[model samples]
Target chain A: MRHISHTDINYADLFADFRDPNSGAVVMFSGEVRDNNKGKAVTHLEYEAYEPMAEKMIDEILNAALEKWPLNKAICVHRVGPIDVCGCAVVVITSSAHRAAAYEANRYIIDRVKYEAPIWKHEFFTDGTSEWGQNCDCSSPSHPHHHEHKHHHAE
Target chain B: METTIQVTCFAGLRKFFNCPLTINLKLPTAYEDVLLEMKKVNPEASEILDSCRIAVCESFVPRTALMTSDEPLFIIPPSSGG
Candidate 1:
């Protein structure tokens, strides 16, 4: 499956594909757009992606996860364009014979995709002002400066 | 002869430059040369350019990496997609 989507993501349709009889565990993660960020009242978000590169990078992340973990299936879908508050922005699913591999691989894929994918988010606020969303502050050691100067989100 | 590299900008760089930009440089141009040319066109973009990463042929390349004309370049600012 392709990594990026321009329309709203249907979680049910995505989850239906993971019906592997041999797989004992399926882990899914959905990153939704919240109504607030950094103390600002966010109205919505517009996501843009360098489509070709973003697809390639997400594919690489999924492939690497499959190689690192014994999995039955792995898939990720990220939405672009305008997304309303509470809208699903991205989703990652991994199925394996055990829960540990499924859980670990799901986390790895989401984290890597967030840092490595060439997708940008533009945030619109209630005060009639907007700004480009800062990239995540948790920088990978390999590309420590990639997210330089961005504010860290306290999870 | 001069070589033209078409650069696709994203996020803040796109909004700053208004659109994708093309820069003409001598052959065997390094990634930094493109940024330099961009700075010449839009001096105000220098700060944003400094923090940007250049991607060639779908992969991020170091500033010193040589660029070819056929491969469309991408100027990626900090990405915030989750």
Candidate 2:
């Protein structure tokens, strides 16, 4: 029933909201924080978001996922705040009559969510270096924001 | 009528814009029009002027989306977070 939560999402309760006898499979995927950042010691992560807009974009993706897949239950959870290594950063759960829908819808949700979601995270390195990951693929050449034919700067 | 917008920037974006996390604007006009007007308030707003993605009421909307919708629009900078 919960679409998004700023606090640590109770992922178990979230998936239970859609559990039904007819649903044969429930697949849950969690992306956790890793302590190693390409051989460098990783510290913690700090995430931020344009809350209102991020929520709006999430609903659109949810609607599209519902239409494209035969999923009876879907839950997407993204954490915004500081998190230590090995903590759950993102969670996606889906239920269907078969494993295929669960697998496909889960994949679709993860990929699309990563590319379209408006959340940002700053990776703190043990050596005092920090880097940010781009949340959207809007910079892609095929993006609608791109000029139809001209290959100009991707703002 | 005046409306407010909250923006959160990431990555190198913070280096360009000072870190307060959010900027509140009260503009007596439409969403698209307000964006143009913002520059007057802070010349630095140009960093997000035309290229930023805007979300209104829990949904990302086109720049052409009307400002007179049922809910006030919220402006967001390009997302550079994972």
Candidate 3:
């Protein structure tokens, strides 16, 4: 299932649930909230999404991944709302009969989710300052300063 | 009869239009018209909205699309979530 959650993601539950007798490899990826960004001390992050569309898009990404890879199971969960430093923000799990498919599919799913999902993040710094993230693919191409700003490609 | 469309903003626009969480637009509206309204009400938001992407009925659409009152409209700022 693809989900946008407010609570922390449970790694143990995800790993256990993704297990399959027919699959020999299982790959899991987690995105964590870091304490520093662009030289500023980040205190926390706030995430938001157009819920219905976000979930639907995630399902589409998974479907694409399944078509491209021989997969046994796959699931992704992302968090919305405030997340503290070192906290988990998103998790992806993929299981396949071979390690290569599992690894490649895992990477494909996360990349599509970050680039295509409707979710957005706003960061709060320790100095009582906050800024909206502007690294999405949806940013206007006509803006003069748009290209000058560096984008944060989700890693 | 007059028609009003409800537009919801998230992330950056949320902080700008958070008091109501949603803004109303008159019928016979296009994406550009909405941006103009934002400029009139909050100039700062207009700057941000200028670079934002818009969605109608939960699907991303071009700024030139004409919108009616019954469909859901969303103003999306550049996303950063992973």
Candidate 4:
């Protein structure tokens, strides 16, 4: 299961669908919005995505993980739009026959989704300034030095 | 026939472009052309996009990748999602 949701993520609803009697292990991961970033106090976070592309890319990430692991179920949910600090932003859940596969696959899905998905973040800082978070780990050859946010001032 | 790529902007770019956006290209276009065009519309976003990545058809493409006008182009600024 994969979705780009605008409403708050319902963890229980997702976990319910993740049940698989054949699987012995289930792993779940949730990422929340924090109140600070790089030493700057944040007011809130606004998330946006190329909705159609974001959903499609998320499926690709899940398919890649399914190929590497013997999994019974895989579910990923990403929330878009304004989220208050400490609100859940994303979740990854995987169920497999063994703990090792479940854990590993869960980690892989989340990491790949973070870098591959067409999702973008706009951080509102307490200083009344906002900036787009750079795609530092997008894993694209075109972004070899994306690790740093390069800014050019208008003359 | 002319091709108009659906260019979706997110986050800061969304605010800048008032997204649900599209760009027209003359048949053959490359990734950099999109960037150049975006810079012309909003110079401030050029710097922000410099730190961003561009994805076509849900995959990140290199600057040199050639795209036709029908393909969907997404200008992805650095992602903060987990």
Q: After superposition, how far is residue A41 of candidate 2 from its true place, in Å?
A: 2.3
Pairs in clash, predicted candidate 4:
A133-B78, A134-B78, A135-B78
Residue-level lDDT tens digits of model 4 in A1-155: 44799999988788888777888898999988889998999999888877887898788778888998998888889999999999988999999989999999998888767766777777899999988775554345654342222322233
- Model 4, position A98, has a per-residue lDDT of 90
How many clashing pairs does model 3 include?
0
Residue A26 alpha-carbon offset, candidate 2, angstroms: 0.8
Task: Return the top candidate by lDDT.
Answer: 1
Identify the CAPRI category of the predicted complex in candidate 1.
medium
Compose the digit string of candidate 2's lDDT tens values, residues A1-155. Answer: 34445677666777777689989999988878889776888899877776665666667667777888898878777888988998777788888899998898887776766666677778899999987754444446754442111121234
Q: Candidate 3 has which clashing residue pairs, if any?
A: none
- The sequence of per-residue lDDT tens digits that candidate 1 reaches over residues A50-107 is 9999999899889999999999999999999999999999999999999999999998
Off-target runs (Cα >4 Å) in candidate 2 are A16-18, A135-155, B1-12, B19-52, B55-82
lDDT per residue (tens digit) for residues B1-82 in model 4: 6577778777766667867667677767777788787888888777776766777766677767777657777777766666
TM-score of every model?
0.89, 0.68, 0.82, 0.78
Indicate the docking level reached by candidate 3: medium
Pairs in steric clash, model 2: A56-B58, A56-B59, A120-B81, A133-B80, A134-B80, A135-B81
For model 3, how does the per-residue alpha-carbon lDDT over A33-137 read when each residue is reduced to its tens digit?
989998999999988888998998788778888998999988889999999998888898999999999999998887777766788878999999998775545
DockQ for each model: 0.54, 0.37, 0.52, 0.47
Candidate with best DockQ: 1
Query: What lDDT does each candidate get?
Result: 0.84, 0.65, 0.77, 0.77
Worst 10 residues of 2 chain A by lDDT: A145-154
Name the DockQ score for candidate 4: 0.47
